[model samples]
Target: MDTIPDNIILHPIGVIRNTTKQPFLVASAAGLTMQGDLAPTMDRVRESEETISEVILKGEFTELLEGIDEYSHIKILYWAHGVPAEGRSLKKVHPMGRPDYPL
Candidate 1:
């Protein structure tokens, strides 16, 4: 089997600033179940539709965003810094933690 190299490294180029203070759902350390009620979760989702977040790039990386305003939409990649280490190891999960969905 191929082994991953040990010298890999990553650095954040920017940070997202938003008003959201809590997550819509919380997963157990084992990633088997989600805590919180579905109604409130949906409410948060609705609230987020009207929320605006700012993505501030580091001073050194600011130039990389030149001409970004010309695009109507863009894709963003982010790290889930709040997830527990064990939760990151989950191989499968129900969509939106809805048990009715197949894993």
Candidate 2:
């Protein structure tokens, strides 16, 4: 396999806007932790269902979204900007911080 370069650059095409101010998962000096239960509560699930989110693209990228309405579903790549530089180096993590799940 080819080795990845140490220096890589990325430009944001758009931003995700949501009502949720704080993140559900947080990475601290100790390790990754959740603000709530390992599994989302019923209320949280309902809140997510009710929440409305939008992807605001940059002016240059706005035209790329044309014809997007024709698709029933689309994929989005999210960037975790809140994570500290060290947190990105984690080799493994339990899915949703659930111990039952293999790392």
Candidate 3:
């Protein structure tokens, strides 16, 4: 009965709360490794083994998740923010200014 046809309301499942002010998190690496200004225009990111995020289900929605633990994997999707206007381009860029890394 709380559903509406014309609108969708998303209650936040969780947040990546952390002290990180710069780019943080990269797969295959441990600990924060932001080399100050390495990618400059782009951004440097690193991931630590520590998990600072949490997912909290609303009290009313908790019952809907009774049998989800059997699943081994899950996916979370979010909109990427903080993109600079100039960062959008159709041109290929040589990653790290190296000719071999054109992308």
Candidate 4:
């Protein structure tokens, strides 16, 4: 059998600063209501980037969200940290998960 490396690596980039108080439970709630004051609230995912606010980026390696507002819309690619290790595994989607179907 091939020997595996004994070392592990870890790096954190930023914090998701939302109006989401109690993110753990609120995020986990099944079909949580976004009515009233919580009507699909909007907030920034704080990062340690030089262009962003300091109160948001409390850690190192957060220089990613800078100048993001210049665009009308921004696409984000990320993994859910709360998901289990097995859940993070890749899966083949139908049509390779393409947005448009073949004519």
TM-score of each: 0.81, 0.78, 0.39, 0.32
TM-score of 1: 0.81
- lDDT string, candidate 2, 8-95, tens digits: 7888888888998866666655556566774464356567778888989989988888999999988988888878988777777766
Ranking by lDDT: 1, 2, 3, 4
Q: What is the Cα-based lDDT of residue 29 in candidate 1?
A: 55
Stronger candidate by TM-score (1 vs 3): 1
User: Compared to the true structure, candidate 4 yields what TM-score?
Assistant: 0.32
Q: How does residue 87 of candidate 2 score in lDDT? A: 77
Model 1 lowest lDDT segment of ten: 26-35
Give the alpha-carbon lDDT of every model.
0.79, 0.75, 0.46, 0.38
Give the Å shift of residue 57 in candidate 2: 0.8
Give the per-residue lDDT of model 1 (tens digit) for 1-103.
8998977567888889899887775566555554467787778788888998899999999898899999998898987788787876788788778787798
Model 2 clashes, total count: 0
With a 3 Å backbone cut-off (N, CA, C), the pairs that clash in candidate 3 are 25-46, 25-47
lDDT of 4: 0.38
Top-lDDT candidate index = 1
Give the clashing pairs for model 1: none
Per-residue error for 46 in candidate 3, Å, reads 5.7
Q: What is the lDDT of residue 45 in candidate 2?
A: 55
The window of 10 residues in a row where model 2 has the poorest summed lDDT is: 37-46
How far is 5's C-alpha from truth in model 4 (Å)? 13
Better of 1 and 4 by TM-score: 1
Model 2 residue runs over 4 Å out of place are: 38-42
